[model samples]
Target chain A: MSKVYTGASMSLDGYIAGPGESGFDHLFEWYFNGDVEVPTASDMTFKLSRASADYLTGYISQTGSLVVGRRLFDLVKGWGGRHPLDRTVVVLTHSVPEGWAPADENFVFVTEGIEAAVAKAAEIAGDQVVGVNGGTIARQCLDAGLLDEVWVDLVPVLLGSGTPFFEQLGTAPVLLDGPVSIVPGDRVTHLRYEVRK
Target chain B: MSKVYTGASMSLDGYIAGPGESGFDHLFEWYFNGDVEVPTASDMTFKLSRASADYLTGYISQTGSLVVGRRLFDLVKGWGGRHPLDRTVVVLTHSVPEGWAPADENFVFVTEGIEAAVAKAAEIAGDQVVGVNGGTIARQCLDAGLLDEVWVDLVPVLLGSGTPFFEQLGTAPVLLDGPVSIVPGDRVTHLRYEVRK
Candidate 1:
């Protein structure tokens, strides 16, 4: 069995981006624009990088597969073909995308919906975790009762529009496991959450 | 001169509403869930209510009247009718809707450009500040450069889609005054922001 973790950064007004699929320039600018009182640059960079690295490595070490939606996949594919997670990547969609896997041998496109996607991802991830990689995908897993934890980097900008991390997730209360950490910055505030199963 | 305070709660991923425009029931739940730890019940209620009251009063104290968008007017016109700051209210829209204001003496209707509306509102407000209520109205003021300050309450919940508090404002960076308070909770978090000038 594997635990699923959904992680992403969002603006203050609940928009991942502004009206259109705007670039994250404003969001990132607000985050990195301020003078943080974190003591040293080495310490700051180490903490930020280590947290992301640990999150990524934790999943991979646990033999977790990556779950992403089509939009996210297209976005990443356009980012100079850089695939951050080098593992079994499961894409949630209806029909398999044309040339979705590209030349990446580690890609496994799952279009059978949220539950089946997680079951397959769990099978492949055995003894590890499943990294819920996008908002829609994560919410789908959550709505389908599969997600285990949700880690977030709470940015300070109020976007006021665009795609959200959790939309139309139906009506159900999610129990929080515990508080992991509160990484504060001049522009962004980070918090981690574990889902209580 | 009138000052506009922008306020709303947001999740770590920047979602204000989960999805659709079902009145953001999830957000209301998250907001009243009381995730943030306050010193005491009386203190907490007072602080929260006072904040809203202060914001409402601060603007109306200077502005003799208020101009709200249709959606906001519909949402809050009932209970807000008798709560303290009982003054003139105007609903702004492209085409005037039926029954725009509460059945009382102080409400008016404006169906024109923001510039005209504000000019008239200013006259009516006199020395008092014109309190612009709701997302559409706020954006109109922002676009017209009529806003002085914005106060946002960053609540934790990702409504995938709904009326954004800032959909049309684009991506201009606003100055963040400070993190006034950090209220924690399982289903929600509260953060306050003041617009820089």
Candidate 2:
């Protein structure tokens, strides 16, 4: 079965983005310096180390679809109608735009709820991993016990306040196992873990 | 010259301790389990790998003194009057307890302020590294640009809400350099960073 996972690059203070920051440029600056080699779904340039690049390459290759939030979809203007992952993108929202048009056969918008969105994404993903993006969507999946893994690229900056990566789950503490891999990049530390059953 | 550094074991969510938790038993549980070798001043039994033990042994041998918050000092009952670091411990507070006796001529309570506590700690630290403890004190020192390095043992736990390790600094983002070393212990990943000047 395909595993469901979430990933993001966050600051030392666990902020995915700083206040008033529209994009993740600052949080992801480490990827652009042309030193490390990591495969990203976006067109943004990145320099990732061989290990990081290999890991990302494997991750992207294994990801069959992605689930994201409407806010994120709007931030990048629907990723110019094509997401970087090149996989089918499922956008979870309260309501679909009246004149929404599919940029490609891969873009999907679900208004019912995160479960429906994830279900649709999983269906599309088949035996491939389903990737969850956006902190809100990720948290929702985590709360629902629908996520299987979490990957984080820890940037060494204290944003102090911004969009927190983790919110109140209202559930008992979640235990994660294995930083299966801890890759030290030039400006980021990559950590991977499997959600304990 | 002695460098002032802050260190703590934090959750992936950036919480130093869970809500209502009195001690770091959960976060530092890995240290208590005899497995990886790490140097500690306390006689508490430990099982450490040669590398981790060496690293810790070197670290403890170089630490000259420690600065901690009153709350933490009270929590451990001043580590039983003598701290594990085996170095002078300065407790920062607003007032000193009446008739407070020196735990062993090494415990000092500074009612003046963080500056005074840190200054006194530095004096005792001399050319050896000065260690700062507690989230509040560490944040204060970081904000004041008095901290030179930070070492964190990242534990894989989602403390939905708790005592956050980093708080709003009300200043621009503070950059850090290095994971100088990333040691994946049985239950924790140890990370070291040099605070960028």
Candidate 3:
């Protein structure tokens, strides 16, 4: 079975995006601060520290599918129909958007909810990990007990206010286990934690 | 000159405290979860992991004084009149409390402003570091261009919602220099980032 996980580059104040959809320039600075090249499946390429390059490439290689929220899907226009990771993306939404369908252009819409979407993503992922978006979708997966891990690229900037990493959690205090891996990168700390079963 | 810095044990979701003033049990778990002893000036002694103990002891051993907001001074009843760290505390408030006075029982009340409070604290600290409380006091120091560093004991739990660290910044996206030190403890990662001057 594919391991289900969620991750994001969160600011020091725990925001994934600052208020009014801002602060990406600071939160994602690590991707552009160093000299080593870490290219996506598409045109975007990241200049990262050697350590980040090693960690990111390994992460990208292991992720086979992603389960994201409709909000994110709409935000990037479905990642231009091909996710930067070049994997199958299962979008959990109330209804499928117009002009997009199932399993075409690397996008799959799931109206059945988080469980069904994650299940489909895991099936598509096979042995690879199912990467889910942080915040809303991640909270749903966590609440449903389908989430196995939480990976965070902790950026150093304090966003002050913005969209927090996981908001409105069903559980008040969600205690997690070891950040099994702590890979220090430029301007970001790649921390991977195991969700308590 | 005393180096000004602010720190707190923050949740993975970037909250210093959870909603309704909750979540300290999860946030301060690292302080009580270790075998090595790190004693403070007061009767309170923390059992910390060796790394955390060393890091914390070194942090505590430096000659210091704390500058904090009136709200925090009132919160713990002035840490029971003697702060756990056993250092002089400068309370920044609009007016001194009804009973407390200057230079008495390790507590000094400063009603002037953030600058005067920090200045008094710095005078007391001398060559040592002048520590500021996170959140309100820290924000003032940063805005005043007085804060030099940020120390965070990053815990693994996600509080979801609560008092965020450095809530409002006069300057958005305050760029920091480095986590010059990263010490991993049993359940906490002690991170120190230098504030850009």
Winner by DockQ: 3
Instruction: List model 2 lDDT by residue over A64-111, tens digit each.
Output: 999999888887888876787688899898777556763347688898
Off by over 4 Å in 1: A17-21, A28-65, A70-82, A85-88, A91-113, A123-128, A158-161, A167-181, A193-197, B9-26, B29-67, B70-81, B84-131, B154-160, B167-181, B185-187
> For residues A1-197, what per-residue lDDT tens digits would candidate 3 score against the true structure?
79998889988778899889999998888889999987887899999999888888888889989999999899988877789889989999999899876667498899999999999999999999999998899999999989999989988887777788887999878889878998988888899999987
Judged by DockQ cut-offs, is candidate 3 incorrect, acceptable, medium or high? medium
Q: Per-residue lDDT tens digits of candidate 1, residues B18-43?
A: 34554355445443443332232122
lDDT of each: 0.57, 0.79, 0.87
Report the Cα lDDT for residue A138, model 3: 93
After aligning candidate 1 to the native by TM-score, how far in Å is the CA of A191 from where it should be? 3.6
Cα TM-score per model: 0.63, 0.91, 0.96
Question: Which number leads on TM-score?
Answer: 3
Mark the 10 consecutive residues where model 3 chain B has the least summed lDDT.
B96-105
* Better model by TM-score: candidate 2 vs candidate 3: 3
- Cα DockQ of the candidate 2 complex: 0.65
| Residue lDDT tens for model 1, A1-197 | 67787766666555556567774875555334533322221223222343444443443466467777878767667233333444667777766667555325466677768887788778878878788865677778887778777766556555555667676666433445434665555456666677666
